[model samples]
Target: MFTSTTIGDLYQIILTNTLICALEDLTTRLNKYKLTACNSDNVENEFTALLENNIRSSCLPIGVENFDGDLAAFFVIENVEKMILKPWGAKNLSLESISLGQYKNEIAAITIKLEDQRRRLTPKLYY
Candidate 1:
């Protein structure tokens, strides 16, 4: 259902789906822990691993276009954070020239809005 042709399109699709998946995982984890939405460190780690594995398997170079707007920003932020904390090598580096900090603020704002919508739309009951 969510397939794409070009790398750019595929990247965007992957990002959107990943974000949705991560958010769902986050909400489930949060509810299980009885928390009201926390930071994204855990989700970010999961997402980074997932993306790294998929990218390696796919054998595709990460492009600036791959990291388009909000989705791209999220990837960049998580990536940089991981790099800082864990100190990994090129495996985590996706885009060549783009600094992860390039769209930092915008991405943060958009992500918050997206998460807010997700929270509102999530069903109170999972039946």
Candidate 2:
């Protein structure tokens, strides 16, 4: 089951197993390396596209949306210790790598948030 969320006039996408996350908020969750070299104007759009494409190409669980962002990021972190940030200053792309620990932290926080969301949304019946 999927529930959609929209924030302001910005964008929203499924970020985890549970939550359709606000891109504005999720952008802050990304580490410096992920944001590096990304045009300041389009970081959220770029990352959202990257995550969606990665999720579609990967063979994750069926119930998990093919466009899930958290799973995609988690998968990438599992495969590599560092993510290359594209070059900031040069017209030529300059890429840099950094620890995936911050990414892991982002995933962990999302997991916690997912747990809370699930708990809050679960039905409670009293007779």
Candidate 3:
């Protein structure tokens, strides 16, 4: 039986789901840790590690043999640094609570670029 799905559709679906999973994992980690000044010393490294790990894991299900290893790493590090510098007063707020929206936007943009790349690779016949 023929299916309605095209390669572009498949690519988008896989990319979206993978990013969603990664975001969910990041959120869980943030909630668990409750980002605070106490952890500030290692937050950059820790956030970068968490984001990079999630992104790499997400790539596995999409059949990506090779990806720019530093793509997410660069963004995560930059954003986390910015977050740390922000004057968010009243210490009880979780880092995730303060930063999740920005992080979500970053992840969405990255996912879009991935989808665009995939589209370019299969141009003329799809997407």
**Predictions in order: lDDT:** 0.35, 0.38, 0.38
lDDT of 1 at 122: 71
Tell me model 2's lDDT, rounded to 2 decimals.
0.38
On the 0 to 100 scale, the lDDT of residue 106 in model 3 is 59
* Rank list by TM-score: 2, 3, 1
What TM-scores do the predictions have?
0.27, 0.32, 0.28
Model 2, poorest ten-residue lDDT window? 1-10
Arranged by lDDT, best first: 2, 3, 1
Clashing pairs in 1: none
Instruction: Identify the leading candidate in terms of TM-score.
Output: 2
- Quote the lDDT for 107 in model 2: 51
> Clash number for every model?
0, 1, 0
TM-score attained by model 2:
0.32
Local accuracy of candidate 1 as per-residue lDDT tens digits, 59-104: 1223234423212212234334311121122234233223324323
- Residues 2-115 of candidate 3 have per-residue lDDT tens digits of 122111223333454455455445445434433323255566555446454455422111232222222221113333522332111322212322244555455456557766
Superposed Cα deviation of residue 45, candidate 2 (Å)? 26
